[model samples]
Target: MYKSLRTFSFLFGYLPVAAMNLKKFQAQKANLSKQEYDALIHTEPQKWAKGIMARTKSRVETSGLDYLPDGPALLVANHEGNFDIPVLLSEIPKPFGFISKKEVKKLPVIPVYMEDMNCVFLDRTDRKSAYKSIADTVGKLKDGHSILIFPEGTRSKGEGVTDFKSGFIRIAKDAGVPIVPIAIHGTSEIMEKNSNQIRPGHVTIRVLEPFSAEEIEKLDAKELIEKVKTTIETEVQSMAQRKADLQ
Candidate 1:
């Protein structure tokens, strides 16, 4: 309880630092190459995320990070909680962005921030807009950027992963990029399971094998998504078992 409150206060404490860094990134966005831009922009946020987790006396343990490809690839992960974003920023070796709802576009600085960070926005209610979103994502990927998507479309909040939406298949197929499956566990315990409170918890991030673009090109949509889902599910179950064993 006190930990959560103090953590929130620490977050607020960092707002000025975040603002200063965002301003710097915004200014540098045009001059840097994609790789340089990703590496530069993600540094501060990653540090901030780790700081927040540390303040709560929480930790993250990750494995199979070598599974991440050096080239562009679509990162697919199970949505467990809000902390998933912070966890990824803190743990993943490389920088990546995710699709956001257009509703966030209305916010003041966010849209620009997201744009500088290589994120895209779409209106879920509009079919045409969704298609455009996919096309835009494909274009970015082809331009040499990696993207992370939560195919479940909603957080399971540690209740076990739900069914994945099929849109990811189209993104990978059209972009000609590989699909990297990431299985994450225990983030929900830090917030969602604690009644929105922060608590000390260990989160696990397992970066499973990637399905190469050649594999993406060969498999049908249904088969591909099924295979990806099964891979993530199997890893998540194994992560759960490990946590239980240490109890």
Candidate 2:
């Protein structure tokens, strides 16, 4: 309870203050050099994410980072919980954005920062909006920015990983980028499993081998989806078993 309260205070207090600074930073975007702007836009999220993880006393460990492609690639990850994003941001040594639900766009000043980071807002209920979001994500990928997507469309909030939707496959094919599969386990224990109360948890992330554009183009939509899903699912199960064995 104490940890949860402290984490909430950080979110509620620190974010608002950061927003004021974000506005001033954006206003000066035209004058600042690209390096200066990029550093802040990317590092700030990592800082906030690490802060959140620290406040909760969570431990995150990642492996297989060498599997990452040399250039921009679609980061496909299964959504495990609310802390999943923070865990990735803090652990993955990459500068990228993610596909966020439209509801997050309503949050105060957070959306402004999300936009700066090239995050896409997805409206799942609105077909047209969802399609537009896909296009936008592809555009960003083509522009040399990596983008992460939770293909499950919603959090499993448990040990199970739901089937991935096929829409993200289109984005990967259209952008002609490699598909990097990521398997994340144990994040939900931080919040979702505790009924939204923050708690210390161990999160393990594994980056599976990436499929090149040539390989992705060879498979049918269904085949690609299942392949990526199976790869991630297998890793998730492996991580789960290892944790259980330790316990």
Write down the lDDT that model 1 would get: 0.88
lDDT of 2: 0.89
**Could you say which candidate leads in TM-score?**
2
**Segments of candidate 1 deviating more than 4 angstroms:** 105-110
Q: Tens digit of lDDT per residue, candidate 1, span 2-96?
A: 99888887666876777788988868879988899888877877887788788878778999998999988899999999889888988997888
Largest lDDT belongs to which candidate? 2
TM per candidate comes to 0.92, 0.93
> How many residue pairs clash in each candidate at the backbone level?
0, 0
